[model samples]
Target chain A: MKYHLILRVVTRLLVGPILLYGLYVQFHGDFGPGGGFQAGVIFAVAFILYGIVFGLRDLRNRFPDRVIHQLFALGVLIYAGTGFVSVFLGANFLDYNVLAEKGYEGQHLGIIAVELGVGIAVFAVMLAIYYAFAARPPRIDDKDW
Target chain B: MELAITLFLFCAIVATAIAITTIRSLFAVVMLSGVISLLSALLFVLMDAVDVAFTEAAVGAGISTVLMLGTIALTSRTQKDIKRNNLIPLAVIILTGLVLIDGTLDMPSFGAPDSPAQTHVGAAYIARTADEIHIPNIVTAVLASYRGYDTLGEVTVVFTAGLGVVLLLGGMGARSRKRRQEEEG
Candidate 1:
């Protein structure tokens, strides 16, 4: 990893754009052809690329396993929380129509919140899985390939 | 031009699948799987399923490949040649493929206006999106609003999978810490 100067430099340049693109997909999902699922994967890819080029230690230090684990649950909580809030407001579970004064406005608000939750959960899960796999010691050496 | 592009992409996908099956090196297999995902993404784009294409490109071509490579790093690069009789499995696959094809024959043609999917709930979702949800993208409206429960369930599924993986592999982290402690001690 240390030897790949080009890779390091290229990854450094690409990570920012990749993350921004993920955000774009997450927010713009309602208008365009993307949502939490694609955005989350894209977000995880940026960090995973950084891990591949820099090192697992650096990545882990930047984003700890604890935070990843918390975010993992936080997303589902956000989704369920939105539904519960709706129920308290005299609407059916996950009924976004009552979220705001205007039905469409409420729908927009609900979708965005739920999508954010989905994005967070998916992103954390992908990264956590990658970390789990990469943290282990390889059974074979690099030269064996 | 569109048909030609679609045909080419399909051919590439088939070639990649064949290569994946025939290749012994796990690394090449992983890369080819990525290639197949990318090609399928292109097909999705061609079919105007951009959201699906994006997901396929991101998850299939990107994350899955990386995960598989990580798995290879932990395991071995070369695949083990298992000397086992494969005739039964091959026959099963062929029979399944034939049955699936036979099932498809009864289905309506691709994009048929009178198709059940086009006429049924799909039409209702499309018609209601503008006035009901006021979202431009019908797919998102359906996924996030109309089918909110389903999306919630999907997120829960992902959460569960992540939890399982962490629980299964949680010991690796502790084991490594112990190894480091021993090395230092």
Candidate 2:
């Protein structure tokens, strides 16, 4: 059998579901218990699992650091941009009531946008931290364990 | 039954902490810390703080555990037995714990209807969430609409922290490394 046969198989089987679950937590935060922070961590966990199994090189190949850099700023921009948009619409900063015709609709839109920003920002940070730590050469080897 | 479960969780958490302190293996200590976080998450659930519970489970137990493991990989797995004066630190910890426990005596009992937290802006948030925001989850409404500025600030901090880590540990790219090597040649 291949090395870490069970782990690799399980990780492959679970990555898709984990990503889906993360999406569910992200989009469903308005109605459910979780919000952006939790969803972002869950999303990053999927890649983390893949990286642990397949190796960091493969993970980096799939998700280039350049993309991570762009996303790191993009999330915050989306959040602040929502506020600026509301301000331009003649409402106060982050005042989502002016986002749509109805106050509630605008609030809903704003929450989703802001939460999306949170989710993206958190995901990038978590993955970036992971990469920083994991990229280092380990003092201990597999046989040492 | 709820109290029983809470008591069990608390006891288990204390036991995990003791185990963590006694254990020389850094790997086991990291795992024990994750256990403490997971137990704390359960306690949050019992207190009806589902959102807090979710965060504790995901970030505290899940992500932090992975990060700690990465740290262990970079460093030694065994903790050094540094025989030093820990009495002062232990005394300070006990004093801090006692002071915190004393402080809690003045606070309202768990889930009391008349507690300051539930009676003040929390009450208003609950009452107006359906009207002003119309979101089913009041927590989301409070976090995103009522407390949008706070969350925006938090996101900015996360972004800044990530940028710092990238600057500190992450080399820009392989291309730069290759260019440097070519220059050296």
Model 1, span A25-97: residue lDDT tens: 9999999899988899999999999998999999998898889989989999999999999999999999989
Q: Candidate 2 residues B63-109, lDDT tens each?
A: 99999888888889998988989899999999999999999999998
Give the lDDT of residue B155 in candidate 2.
92
The lowest-lDDT stretch of 10 consecutive residues in candidate 1 chain B is B168-177
Q: Which stretches of candidate 2 lie over 4 Å from their true place?
A: B171-185
lDDT of 2 at B37: 98
Off by over 4 Å in 1: B171-176, B179-185
Global lDDT scores for all candidate models:
0.90, 0.90
Model 1: per-residue lDDT, tens digit, B1-185?
A: 88888889999899889778778998999998998999999999998888888899888988888888878888778889988888999999999999999999999986679988888898999888999998798889999999999999999999999989988877236566787889999
Question: Could you tell me every candidate's TM-score relative to the true structure?
Answer: 0.94, 0.94
- Scanning candidate 2 chain B in windows of ten residues, the lowest lDDT window is B169-178
